[model samples]
Target: MQILNVFLVIFLIVAAIMVERTKDLLSAVIIFTSYSLMMALLWLLLRAPDVAMTEAAIGAGITTNLFVVVISRTRRTEK
Candidate 1:
């Protein structure tokens, strides 16, 4: 249990950094979605089921959908 918590924290940190580091907008959105999901899981681990549900719904679900829609409307660049 302790190890799992530590791993989740580390994974969350990496996901956050990755979201910022990614140059592609789509990839960054994907990473942000993963980060939100991980946050939901962490909230569950911390005994905050209500917060977890909210994070999953709003952070991962609605927010991600909005970002995808916006990205689809914008022009993409590749290196």
Candidate 2:
């Protein structure tokens, strides 16, 4: 579990960098989705299924949709 925690932390750090450096909104959103999935996995490992479910739904699902809608609404930002 400790080793897994270290690995997860590394993955999250990489994902965060990817999210921050991405120029395209859509790519940033996809990285965010990956971050959310990682959060869910961490929650599951910590024995918090409820939090994991909420993270998955709100972070990965609804948030992604909202990002997509906002990106669609703004045409100038598209690459």
Candidate 3:
């Protein structure tokens, strides 16, 4: 449990950095989605199941879908 938490935390940090540094908008969105998922898992492990579910639904689900839609209508790479 402890190890899993630590790994997820590290992945979150790296994903965050990658999202910011990435030049491809779609790639950034993918990384951001993963970051949200890791966050949701962390929240679940922390005993905040309600918050975790909300984050998973909103952060990973709705937001990612929205981003992909917007990206589809525009350029996929940063200029």
Q: Which candidate number maximizes TM-score?
A: 3
Clashes per candidate (backbone, < 3 Å)? 0, 0, 0
lDDT of 3 by residue, 1-79 (tens): 9999999999999999999899999999999999999999999999999999999999999999999999999999888
Per-model TM-score, in order, reads 0.94, 0.88, 0.96
Q: For residues 10-69, could you state the per-residue lDDT of candidate 1 as single tens digits?
A: 999999999878789889888999999999999999999999999999999999999899
Provide the global lDDT of candidate 1 against the true structure: 0.92
TM-score for candidate 1, residues paired by index: 0.94
Alpha-carbon error at 34 in model 2, in Å? 0.5
Clashing pairs in 3: none
Per-residue lDDT of model 2, residues 1-75, tens digit only: 999988988999999999888788888898899999999999999999999999999999999999888988886
lDDT ranking of the models: 3, 1, 2
- Taken over the whole model, the C-alpha lDDT of each candidate is 0.92, 0.89, 0.96
Error of 1 at 56 (Å): 0.2
